[model samples]
Target: MSKSQQHDHSPLHIFLIFLRMGLTSFGGPIAHLAYFRAEFVDGRKWLSERSYADLMALCQFLPGPASSQVGIALGLSRGGYAGALAAWAGFTLPSALVLILFARGLSSLGESVSAGALQGLKVVAVAVVAQAVWSMARTLCPDAPRITLMLLTTAGALLLPGMWTQIGLIAIAGVIGARLLTPVQAINHAPLNVPITRRTGVLWLMLFFTLLVGLPILTHLLPWTTLALVDAFYRAGSLVFGGGHVVLPLLQAEVVPTGWVDNQVFVAGYGAAQAMPGPLFTFAAFLGASLQGHPSGFIGGLICLLAIFAPAFLLVFGALPFWSAVQGNRRMQAALSGINACVAGLLLAALYQPVWTSAIFGLKDVALALLAFTALMYWKLSPWLVVVASAFIGWLVL
Candidate 1:
């Protein structure tokens, strides 16, 4: 897979392609997958059909943003570590830059326009998140235990919005998965050792965790502004489970409370993020561009990018090394199973609280939400088109 010697693509061309994907790739993980399949698997022939599918599966199995991970992997295939970085840049740069520009515009817009836009944006968020819940439920909730877990996860998230609470749920599921989902070989082996790659990934996890905990504490005493922000995003990117919407909850915890971005503004940025293409992680671009102290904008976007994706890259490079050997392990499978079930719950929970409750404020709103959902589910419309129609409808309804 080495690209150092002979390759059809130069590093720059590969980088540019990813950048375009970042700039224009929208729709949630599934949509992102379709886009990737079209461009890389069908159009570019950058990845063979089988290889592309394998990469998508690997990303789906891991935590963090799956689509971003896929694009990064595609980048790595092109030129190793450098290629990966290039891909990250390509995928994120457009959104980051565009968001920054948007933030600047928002800063200047009169209150009347801003207020109306913000209100409309929140409604859009509600609709978008609702769609996520319904789509994921079908894909992830095939069994009863999983369906129950999804329900529980949603309830727990609503009842307790604490950071540790979220992490605790994910951890608890991991244990259940280990027991219930252990593979046949792992069962036969009796006890399996952690692969060196997983160990490397764990080390990165711990190292990053240390920075996350320590940097903020250190910054109060010293002058390490960037480190704290970097650590925040690095941690956010690394630890988050479901992509896009999941990160929204985490980012809300880290930033909004601190007055980083006002609640409505964040919602608006999210509304705007959906309008673009690429991974939903580009919402990080908006946070970076708009945050006070200006860190949330350009500089903040960089931190968010690294924070959100760094762990993913490490895990991909690290664990994927051992994934081939461990794929059939029931325990590994179980863990993913449990995690995925919870993931379904997480989305469902999200769908109810912020999405359904807040978005469906009135009868008209509910009708619109249902209409949009039906279009997506049955008519199989493009998300972008739905979003555009929804935005106008939101404006009209308001």
Candidate 2:
């Protein structure tokens, strides 16, 4: 069928299509991208391969979760603004809800079972993040220059150990990339059919920045916990450069220091999130629901979930109209290359700090993490299965 003839332009149809994928898609961001390609580009003939690649590139260039942004862009292409939202909701809500429930039920578990399971989750997180670092290093830090950038970023982050430090490193890396690095080969793709006008795009971009800057100021002035929650989550969502995994360090810095969520709980939720089948950004929902104080339960989860994802919504809509103009710019690509390498380094730092130190207590934990990593990297076992097995082992043996 022709593209137009096969396409279902209704927002509801878009939601339903993504909802199914939300429930079934696993592996992680890269795997999610593959699933999107199969279902949208090939199975449904929603768009051509080139268009899909174009959308993926645009999403990669932006800050928020790339897979979710790509889904939003795909929805926008077919169903307009509402479709974009529908796509995000469909792809995000299943996991968000599941994580929220996990957060709520965690407290009710038997003490020993909870401790064991949580430790298992934490151990698996170490394996998952280690795998991410290994995989991203292979892809993002391919050459000596980028490898140096990655190593330097890791060192700086480990030494400085704060959110601002990570952001500063990313900015510096971008500048270095633009000045020192050459752009990689580019693939030409068809123009995206974004329905948003430049004028609308500008307004969306403005809102994105407005929230980024204003939320912190508002939280500081008002002393509202909810607003603070929004600010922290929003900034994490906005500043994230690489992918969902990169958000780990940002979020730990945000919630852990403030005493909003315990460090152990944070790492445990992150591990549990790995078992869920959707954008890892739903990890925000888990954090929100697990908040220590007011607005915590379902409301907290909803607020944090929306706050973190708001930037993704705004950026994809805002950047779409302008993407065609800048897509071919070598300098822009170079800067992004540096930023990605730094992000990988940031994740490496995170793996050591909260994911590793918090989880690995002894030889048993080390064995479990190594086993999980081997399962992921060599055996190619499904991540969810590894997570489950790890949790069971923790309960039984740890």
Candidate 3:
């Protein structure tokens, strides 16, 4: 087949590729994107370069986490619904398990250094997110109208930091974009060609979600430690947006506020998560470990882990067969438009106040961030390196 005509969108293959991504992908979103390009574009030739770029743009245009969304998009291109689940599981599992492991080690550490490390980690998170905005803007926000929406959303988010408010703006932006920009004809529209008949489609979707919902319940009912693990992961997986960092507060809300974990321990685990290379949801691991003294012990850890990751899995699977349908639907598209615009706003708001102000603690942090940005944008060093260097620099200066 011609390079443009290379059309192997196999579900099993996608699962395997993402399994590799789960195992190896790290360095946050930029690093994850680079890994994705390596796997899908250079290694497999699954998508033409232009098509891959277009797909990346589309993912950025949506809500939720960009890397996760991109991974799902890739799987959808490969094997329709099944491919999406495989991709999510593959990319998420390694990091999730790693975080859990890290959590076990964290409980014994003192609170002070852990808190400092976490604060630094937040800087890394903010910087990386800003990097995403810059990269996406260069491509996704190119047009006059889109740029307008991007800036506008940023302004709105600055004034209002609430998640839903930010989400609303993206939906509006999508509407304006659809009206203004031409429909981006995807190069590989293979997954959109799902042959799921109506009855089969409904049946499959129902069964898929049922399994997703039932698995956690069944796991919960079990007296095994696995039940708690499953529960924790499921909750975290199900709701986190903008990747694992966003779940910081969610974990706090679910566990801390409920007295599942205390403040000192919570802060310490959050810090260690920053020191790690995997996803932020790894905080769940820390939470699980700390729960050792609780009634559930291992079960609690297991539950936290499972609850944390379940949402993402559920969303990915539920939307698998509906990828094309969601992409094409007017109302869903409208809501997504607002959500995307809100995400942009959220990023912008994040860029200014907490992300920038908190990190730019006087001249030193600013210097580090500028240096980091330069290394990323101009020197083109790997993002993980930037993060590590930034942490060391921060530690040294501190």
Candidate 4:
């Protein structure tokens, strides 16, 4: 098929396609990738398997939600920058809306969802995160050295337990990896036909860093709550590596300690997010709507939803033009390797503190969590089904 005929190349069409998936794609990031490949590669023939794999690899290397970045990249390839936005909107909005409503219900009705059901959600979060840790550890920390790095990262994160500490550990891990580790040689893939020029790509990169560095300073000096909100969520989005699950730790660090969101609520919302279909980053919408003070509704949800995702948009667009050159850099790959290990470590730490300590209060809670984990890990049941069943169990027993 001709290039024009192979892809619709219409922003609206792209939005509608992703919107459908946003509603129906129940599995997490890994599953989202499979869905994307089936639709865009096998069904639509928008790109060849090699090109799609290349895109996925590039997104995996960059820091942010991988599946969302892939969607944005695909949109950019087919529909330009506008298409990227449409793709993100289509894929992101459904879950964001659901989470926002969930948050609103919690805020307005306080006990609309029973404490047991909410606790069940929190218990399920433990299983979800444990699965993430297990899966990522196998992939990112295979060798002894990388495993040591992950263990040390977990130790440092637990001892220090803050956003800055997590950042410091990631940086330190990268340095260690760059100095000590040797990455496998990179493979070459067919060039992606993205519309962005390298010069424009450079400009986007500059803007990404500018906002990354400048936003904190701006928020510090100005004391505008909204800007602070932006700074927090943007930083969370900017630094999240590994996968959507990693965002759990980064976000809990950003929102929970600051009194912006309650810890219990945060964990509950995370559980709810797992049940939702789309990017788990839409958990930002829940945190936003659950904010303690001003801007704690749809408006807050919009602001935070945009802020957290903005980095992904900028990074994916900016990096696409330069991916070919950077993808093969040995040191860069090594650094990403270290960062991924540290990310798994961070999640490990989080699974202990907020997710485990809060939810697994009694032996019954422990039993429910184990059951949920078994259902997720072995039975291969749908996550939403597990979530609903866990909620019912929590209501019935815990």
Candidate 5:
């Protein structure tokens, strides 16, 4: 490993770096991943491209906000427990704070302002995710079989349209890739300098499962609204796959149907979240603060925020050690290849349905999307720059 890889990053430094990203990583989860790649992989050389891709595959396999999980994992690799916490705080706090304020002031903000900016944000999402699908496809699905797998996964996700289908598709793709795809060999084969030991990882894994199994029962016995919030958000976090966008329906089902939040308010918050520069899971914070009774405000936001993200942190720590253990296993590597390809497909599917369908209503929207894409791909402007331009241009035009 180079000295750069071995150098210890201060927790404060990690927090600051991620805070900058949190403030500027606009679009959505897919776009956030692209920004992470640019900052961590390309700019900082914090990890190899292959390792970054492998870590993303792991995040995709497990449930939670994929981009947020990736940020947490990166922090862990860089600065241990404090780094992970700092990363989550820095990347999440900005959006959570904004959304909570939005929740508190929903009556004043109104729909018109949010609607136009949201349209702009959605257009930016289309461009950012398009770039991601293209880049990831080249990296993860270069071969015919992998390309076929990508296409099939995209089709399945579009045709079926649910979290379960997305999970099953990824699982099936893993199985198929293990059997059929070329075994992936690590490029540099460097062990990630993750801070936790195998024993600690095992303990974390046990705690994760314990909570997964016990939280619901605890909620049932307690019968408190806060506990209910915990149970609802925890279940949504544990089950969602693909990325932040997919979390929408799951969260909507959990909170909206329960009368915890109005459907219109839930939807408006979702739109605003797309425009913000952080993890989509932070929407939980908005919902929590927006709740009709008890624990509303900062306290409620804190509860929902932690509940929703706990599983992702647990799974990352638990899985990292085992990931190191399985590095040499050809079948495991092959499965990851398949999983990565399918992840590309998932992004592609998301681009079409919610992103493309919602954002592209006419030639004007189409023109804006193309302009944003050009700014990113050809002009090679910073994504934040592109996002800002798209938002302002959209505000004026739309």
Candidate 6:
């Protein structure tokens, strides 16, 4: 049966399905991807495995929340624009609301919350990123040349820390990949038959680029506080590659040095974010709510949330019309090969700097991280359970 013939085409059905996933989905992006594959592909048969994998690859190459973009793409194929909105709202709102409320309550707590627990959460992040790096490296850079590219990318990222450096490396890797990486034999996939048209795709891509260029200038000229906030968050979202975890470094560069939110609060929110179900981009909500500027409340949270996600939506819509055609192209395959390898390397760099450096201080920290990693890798425990356990252990020992 075609996607059009599937039952439960209502936007509400889409919303409810995603909402359940949002509430229960744990681990990080990788885990979320697993849950999504099981639910949509294996259980519901909403998409064939080949089509799902193709969509996943497309979203992976785009600069935004990868899993979230996949979810949006799935919704669009299922129920069109309204379905996409419903899917996003359901998957995102749970975590966003929690973080917003947490920020509000955190302000009242002052210094009373357990620092050890927070540190534990950061340690959990270390384990989580480590797991992601291992998983992605195995899948994305299995070949010797790809492995070499991954190492080079990691070294360059560590040596030169900036958004431009990240972008430059990805671009260079793509060029090299086009020259070097062998293309995979393309597998034919069932067409999703989404409603996006070439014209709409062009418009979405144009708007994406326009906002990328125009938002900064508008903020600079107008100097409106809200505009600036949107600009900052939007840029953070626009430039993020790999996955949501990478947004950490980009966002830190944007907000932390500027003192928009204190380092302690930022770390706390990030640690808490690991425990949340949906996209790690929802961390923007916490930052907005915790901000000391004009948009520092519910409205601020909403604005920042919307701004950060807008780029992903635009890019997905823009690319959807052409994705199937490009998926089978050798040139596009080579580019993806390079880009995916670099993404693994980028995740490695991220794992070391902010995640490992900040979280691991002593033997105790190492032990806790190892324990969490074991739970995730060996025991095959739920990430949420590992997170809660790690926090408890941290509070007790750290």
Q: Candidates' lDDT values, in order?
A: 0.64, 0.80, 0.58, 0.79, 0.83, 0.80
Q: Which residues of candidate 4, in runs, are more than 4 Å off?
A: 1-7, 106-190, 324-398
TM-scores for all predictions? 0.58, 0.64, 0.66, 0.64, 0.86, 0.69
Off by over 4 Å in 3: 1-127, 184-267, 292-303, 325-346
By summed lDDT, the worst window of 10 consecutive residues in model 6 runs over 183-192
Better of 1 and 5 by TM-score: 5
Predicted model with the maximum lDDT: 5
lDDT of 5 by residue, 249-333 (tens): 8888888888889999998888777667799889999999989888888899899999999999999999998887886688888
Superposed by TM-score, candidate 6 places the C-alpha of residue 284 at a distance from the truth, in angstroms, of 5.6
lDDT of model 6 at residue 379? 83
Q: Candidate 1: misplaced stretches above 4 Å?
A: 1-87, 102-106, 109-132, 177-312, 319-325
Model 4 score (lDDT): 0.79
Report the lDDT of model 6 for residue 200: 87
Per-residue lDDT, model 6, residue 56, is 62
- Model 6 residue 162 CA deviation in Å: 2.2
Candidate 4 vs. truth: CA RMSD? 7.4
- Candidate 1 has its poorest 10 consecutive residues by lDDT at 183-192
Q: Runs in model 2 with CA error above 4 Å?
A: 1-7, 106-190, 325-398
By the TM-score metric, which is better: model 4 or model 6? 6
Q: What is the lDDT of candidate 6?
A: 0.80
- Model 2, residue 235: distance off in Å is 0.3
For each candidate in turn, give its C-alpha RMSD to the true structure in angstroms: 7.7, 7.0, 6.1, 7.4, 3.3, 5.6
lDDT of 3 by residue, 1-398 (tens): 56433335556666676776665443455446655664566457676543454454444543346677678767755676677767776776665555556555634543445444444554555556566556545544445655677788878877776556644565566666556555434345333334445555566547646755777778757755555445545655554545666767766776666566788878877766654544556567568767635544445555665566545444444444555566566555443443444344455566776557766666656666677778766786655566666666666664
Model 1 per-residue lDDT tens digits across residues 1-398: 46654454466877777766665454456546655665665456575543453455456556788878887777766666677778878877776676667776764323334333334444544555555555445555566776777788878988996545666777677678677653222112221122345666567556655765776677677765566566677778776765777788888887788777789888888877765556778777677777788565566766666666677777666655465566456576676566666765655665665556655667766677677667655786654456557666666666
Best by TM-score: 5
